[model samples]
Target chain A: MFESADLTILAGLLSRYLVVLQAQQALLNSCTHFYQLEPRLARWLLMTADRAYSADLYLPLILSVQQRTYNTADLYILRSLQVAGCSVHWQAANDKRKFF
Target chain B: MIKENFFEQNHLLREFPQDVQQRLFPLLELISLPLGKVLYESGDPSNFVYFPTDAIVSLLYVMESGASAQISMVGNDGVVGVSLFMGGESTTSRAVVQCAGSAYRLNGQRLKDEFNRHGMLLFLMLRYTQSLITQMAQTAVCNRHHSIDQQLCRWLLLSNDRMPGNDLHITQELIANMLGVRREGVTDAAGRLQRDGVIEYSRGKISILNRPQLEVLCCECYAVVRTETERLLPWVFQKGCTVKTTEASMSAAKAD
Candidate 1:
């Protein structure tokens, strides 16, 4: 589902947001499957990717396994993003789309 | 015999040519791999090759952001540091103790010296490496294609195969972390399995209640890896449930 363009965009997004080249690449390298993420997951990571230097922004998407439920940890990240004034749009792949 | 006592406890070490076995036994340092202990990290120099007698070590890739996922698992059927022999002085994955138990470790230099002789040990290690490769590749495929529920079954089966008992001391969160999935997904799947009596999960421990039912729920990936492992390492056996020991069984070789 991800591509090099997405990676370039992700790296650009992360680097520009974090402003640390070393940290950017390090986070990218650590997240082995960084570009192969669903759009929603990528956006979620990008939103939180700027919180300090803990740039595990692409982590949620790196593991090839698919998981559907949004647990407390997932909620915590989304909640953190919302509290920071970033409106979060969370959706599970199987859930029906809401117009709101 | 005192020095060689535990060699029999490890299938790989036991199958070694007597001359090679004699050379390695004294050098082997029997040690305990406590659960969650990080043995090596990505790009770290491996100083020793660990031969797990009962413990299971997971090879995981940790992201710079601290997220980690397992790539493969090593047990008594294999060695821990294949990158040492595969010409990479450092590995790209982290080795962690999954099922804490005993293992025999040999200094990397000594292993290299022994492997340089181009004998049965080297041949066996190479064969074992092939099986490890299959497992790593299969894990990648499984992670990419299988559902979290199916992956859990595979993980449980693989861990169960390495362990000496039916119970596993791991949490859904850890399993989710290893599978690179959401904890909620694991929680749900484990709950379903628990409800069906396939397993009993509580207090971060999962006990396999019905082995046959668990097998019925797993994907084909489990069988493929198990079969390939036995094919590559002819000595790898269908282990029966036994008491897991924390103490190093260095004297177990005497029984062989």
Candidate 2:
């Protein structure tokens, strides 16, 4: 349903995004000992927001998908973000509420 | 000295200039790499660099808590022990044989000497290193963003590309270790894949039943690594194409 030109442009943009994402990941991996969790979390949140095109994001789903458990530091980081004008909500797994 | 034909089995060695091949062939020691063989442990000084002809090696970064994840994989299309030529005698990653096969090993010093010549070997090694970096970076991103099922598909596709057959002689436990996930997670994912008719797993062996479906199910990480690798090392794939064409023409002539 799409024209060739449109597909080409989309492919180009996707490739550019991948390249930048790769560079960012490589940097984070190489400097794991140098950077603290706060900056890393902030960067991740900002990138997620940009990609999702919304400030309202779901962290629990991401945590479950990555098979990661939140520690005190992670909870503290979320609280700090909430204090910085970002609304934070905790929803149970069975909750049917949709906040878009 | 091993037979000269053995060199052709490895794409990187196959593309060596005739003179370079003649010089290097005498130095290569062919050895069988068994599954779970530790080529080099993390932080250990590497003594030899291996050019795998039919083996798959996983470069894993081990954490302090004893967990590890594969950063990249090296097979016939490339060489192991980049740190040897990259001027680092040791790396934080451990290289282990993921599949049982043979590889031609060269003394680390000998490879370093050859690399310093700034010839075809140097050029190829640099390009291969770039591709390896791309793979490692893509793996980091995949680990962060992709689901376990998608990651398993990506892993299978990448491993399938480096070997000869549709069957992979690896266990779910080893795959779990490589992905840094629980064994149960891999079991569930592999089960789903089998149910979908994409693969068949039986007693540590996995046979890919439908490659097209597997690719469709894989994440973009696999394609990103494959594209970058082919772009950085075009000669590796080109050599394969040339051989296929030569065989086809020879068969046609024989038929006449």
Candidate 3:
């Protein structure tokens, strides 16, 4: 019974590599479009994203994903370190899970 | 001369802290994943984990009657063997290469050793595992509730996003096998997509002419999977991964 969603998990991670990248580009394009069509809505989204605590890390990755020529090796190294820090944070979260 | 740094495009290797990645580079075996090649069949103990650079692999759930349906698709963004890490030691599904391209295969023992460290590599993999769980859950919902046309669209979008080009080299029979539907159903759904000008299908090659329309016509399953994947594992969110940088650092490993 461990078929526990095998294909979904693989595709989940795999397809998102494109989805997130393309979606970020698409969202940017839509934002630019919205800025022209509906400035308030565009501003709201920008503000909302800014409030997210981890947006600092995510926003640059999204921006870099958009840039056609930016070197990613450096970004990959930094992101790995940042993510590793989160895992120790994950261990803390796992410990907290015992409470519930 | 054997090429260098080809694995840099692979996200798993790229995401590894440089030193950890450097340690694994020499052991990597870059090989061609030809179309229709089975990476592993049910119950096979995984000997290697493949990081697809430009290929696509479909995991299919086979029935006792020999019928099967694709459970998931793995592209350059993912590795072929997850069971190796999940403590399963084996998988019951069949992994077949859908696209003809290349991948870097690392010995399973090496992956196990790295994973055991519980450091950055293990951390990243655990996060990846979360996204996979979301995807698996969504697939079940989509399979049960969505239309055949919608399924075809999702499957096409998945396969299309995996490889480098716009067109996919696939046949209706193969699509049927993956979707666990009849050949006639795939032909019919594909015909509708072609007629709507969303895709151009000719001689087993599908070229996506309009992705927006396909997305619009697709069910919510695709969107749900995409959003959750980004939310759970944002590290893989990047483009132009194949672009080469710092070949000097990469090539230094060759002498070792």
Q: Top lDDT: which candidate number? A: 2
What TM-score does chain B get in every candidate? 0.91, 0.92, 0.89
TM-score of chain A of each: 0.22, 0.41, 0.27
Q: DockQ for every model, please.
A: 0.04, 0.06, 0.02
lDDT of 1 by residue, B29-127 (tens): 777788889888888898989988788898887766687778788876778887765445677688998877878888887877676666777678767
Spell out the clash pairs found in candidate 2: none
RMSD of 1: 12.7
Point out the worst 10-residue segment of candidate 1 chain B by lDDT. Answer: B247-256
TM-score of chain B of 1: 0.91
Model 1 spans with C-alpha error above 4 angstroms:
A1-34, A37-100, B1-5, B238-243, B246-256
Candidate 2, residue B185: the lDDT equals 97
Q: Which fraction of the native contacts appears in each prediction?
A: 0.04, 0.08, 0.00
Stronger candidate by TM-score (2 vs 3): 2
Candidates in descending TM-score order:
2, 1, 3
Worst window of 10 by summed lDDT in candidate 2 chain B: B241-250
lDDT of model 1 at residue A99? 13
